[model samples]
Target: MKKVKHGGNIYEIAEKLGIQKEEIIDFSANINPLGVPINFKKALIENIDRIENYPDPEYNGLIQAIAKEHHINREYITVGNGATEVIFSMIASLKPKKSMILAPTFGEYERALMRAGSQVEYFHLKEENDFQVDDDILKTIDESFDLVILCNPNNPTSQMVENKRLIKILKHCEKNHVHLMMDEAFIDFVDEPTKETMLPYIMNYHNLIIVKALTKFYALPGLRIGYGITSNVRLLERVNDHKEPWTINSYAAMAGMVFKDKIYREKSREWITSERKDFFDELKKINKIKVYKPNGNYILFKLLEERKDLREVLLKKKILIRSCSNYKNLDESFYRIAIKDKGLNKLFAKALKEVLYES
Candidate 1:
């Protein structure tokens, strides 16, 4: 299996441009602009010696933290190196023979499904509809599919499924005995995260599984900690049976500590609530590209004219944005950029205008 490429690779872009990675402004990865939490950093430094010992094989403390955060039972939770491990492990345990996913959604789902020997199908989201999920998906899913994956506030597009419609899908999947895995990696950044999350549906629907990452919201992508929640004990046991031990490092296991950082959480919500609207409105003013309204911490836009190489041009100015051409439903004209700090976002907007109009 050749590896899949993801955003946030400032190192490679910097190397190619003959500059330090920090010199490049990266809008490629959808991460919290506030950076890692200060309290967590201090804790990490104070307890650096924990690395000398192996992480708890079951990651008890981490699971407890996640449970407390969601007000769920520890029995329903499972941890992994990142969201990908939980996803792959879930698929491996379920061993689905067939699965369905959104066409332009996260790429890792398809890879994991394939690795588990499942035939894959796509629910192609149309660009004309602003890439939103609708009732049409109900017709596409049936007993034929053993699993269905959804990325809430989907990557690249940054559009979320409406709650009523999302529940309908979950219920439909339940009726068909299909496992519905909702990836809530970006849900924390959504305007109404509590209302939009599938976390609440887990206890009532054993078939529903929710996976989340501390990577984006906590700005700890490098730490590699993520988890999954479901009410199905058998499924959790299966995931544990076949999983490798100590997948999370000692530092990553301390992820549970960050959940109680309410100050950081409030500040992050403030940033998204402010930045998302401002960034979307600013991009809308640029007639050269069509910007999609964003619920997550990123914006997806399409170049209006013939400038398919917009990504390349922006790189010359030491700016890196995600090229979404690799996504199934998207084309070369499509791109996704992260919502950074106010100053950096303004600088990006200026650089973009210069490339499109002046240059």
Candidate 2:
């Protein structure tokens, strides 16, 4: 398999452009516009000495916070360095004979599934439907496949599967004895995280496994903290066995404190509510591009004017946008960009319009 390329690599872009990484206005990685929460930063600095000792192998404190937040048993949760670790560990432990993933979804799922030596297949999300998951997916799940992966408010596309439909898929998967791995990494950015999340369903569906990232919502991607939830304790145990001990560092172990930052959470909610709409609307004004309605903090668009050089042209303006050419089912005309703060969002809109509309 060729290596999977992800967004947020400023190092290579900077080197290529002969500019500093900090100088790049990144619209690649879909992370919170708000920087790290103040309380967490303070806690990290105050407890910097904690690094002298190893993190608890069980990560009890971290799991306790997660369980408390979602009102589930700590036994239901498993932590990892990031969602990546949780994903890789879960697939390794499951050792499925075959699996399915959404095409043009997160690249990591295919990588993890392939690493586990599973036969992988793609359920391509239709471009005509704006890459939304339709009832057609229900027809795709069957007893033959042991696993199916879903990225809710899916990456790059930024479209969400309706919870009603998700329940149908969940029931269908359960009946077929297939595991449904739901990646809710960007759920925190959605308008209704509680309503959209499949977290509540994990208790009833042993086949359901939900992977989440605190790094994206809390702007601590550098610290790398994420987790998975499932009702099956045996599955959790297997995942634990696969994961290395103390994979979370001292700084990352402090991630449990982020849930208590309710004020920060509210502020982030407000920002996403206001900015996501404004940013999407701003891009839709350009007749040269077709912008999809976004449920998460990122938006995917296609250049309708036959220009494949948008990424490179935007790079010259010291702006970095995610080119979706490498993603399956997407071509060079497609791009994905993060919803940054107002000024930056406006700057990106202007930059994009100037390039696309230029005679």
Candidate 3:
């Protein structure tokens, strides 16, 4: 098990740069620019005393919020401290001998799969194809693998797997006796989550599992609440049985209440829907980099010409963007940045141009 570097490392970057954390404009983390929901903030203030009690090991309230939001049975939901916790618990319980993942998708999947002693294989998404998972994925999955994990609107690429193609792959995995796990953590920020999600198929396929996170869209990364949904009763039970009790803190448990806060949710949806297009179009005009069309709340770009270490240059300007060098299939020319407020997006664009032409 080799240790791998993870992104959104503003603290480390700030320490090395000798600057205050607040001074950096972090476009590294794909978090909502709206910041934490106002409803969650008020709840935290009013119930600050919640810190005294241990969070319910059962997490009934959290599960109910998720279930009601998705219009699914409460029994199908399993909450975790964050999506990462659920990911680790599920992979550990399944104990698959062989697992498959996307080469440049979120890194944690490989880490979790490897920790469970599974032989990992990658469906190397091609750069020429703009990193989309194509029909070939169905042909690649077979009986040899016991588990397959995919990140829709995949990280570092921000490219979505079409619903039709995803269903075909799901059917392929199901017939092959391979468990399919879809990480829809960023799905809420996608164009049409209702149409794209695999949640609707869970009831029909016991082999299907969907993981979601409140950390990204809800801007509650600090609160650390995430969950996995599956109709596979046996595997769900195994996940619960192996999970550490109280992994979700009291604040995290209450943070789930904000999910149903319609006002905040709508505002977030409107912001992402309207701003992402303009931002993507603007990035396209920059000659210094090649921007990948985004389907999520982040855009992936590659530097052109001689400026390979652009991330280091931007850090000097107190802007933190994710350098994709550590990702399995990415290198120095690549980086990923969050789609933020219009003003911040402009700030990033200006800073990037300045770094390119003036630095």
How much is the lDDT of residue 249 in candidate 1? 97
Q: State the lDDT of candidate 3 residue by residue for 1-359, as single tens digits.
A: 78767667778888998888889899999999898888779889999898888878898888888888899988888999899999999999999999999989999999898899999999998999999898988888899999999998799799999999989999999999999999999999999999999999999999999999999998888888899999998999999989878988888888668876889889999999988998998889999889999999999999987754888888878888888988988888899999999999999998888888885
Q: Rank the candidate models, highest lDDT first.
A: 1, 2, 3
lDDT of 3 at 87: 94
Off by over 4 Å in 3: none
Native-referenced Cα lDDT, model 2: 0.92
- The TM-score measured for candidate 2 stands at 0.98
Candidate 2 vs candidate 3: the TM-score winner is 2
* Model 1 ranges off by over 4 Å: none
Give the per-residue lDDT of model 1 (tens digit) for 71-160. Answer: 999999999988989999999999999999998998898889888889999999988899999899999999998999999989879999
Candidate 1 local lDDT, residue 154: 94
Angstrom error of the Cα, residue 296, model 2: value is 0.3
| TM-score of model 1 vs. true structure | 0.99
TM-score of each: 0.99, 0.98, 0.98
Better of 1 and 3 by TM-score: 1
Q: For model 3, what is the error of residue 274's alpha carbon versus the real structure, in angstroms, after optimal superposition?
A: 1.7
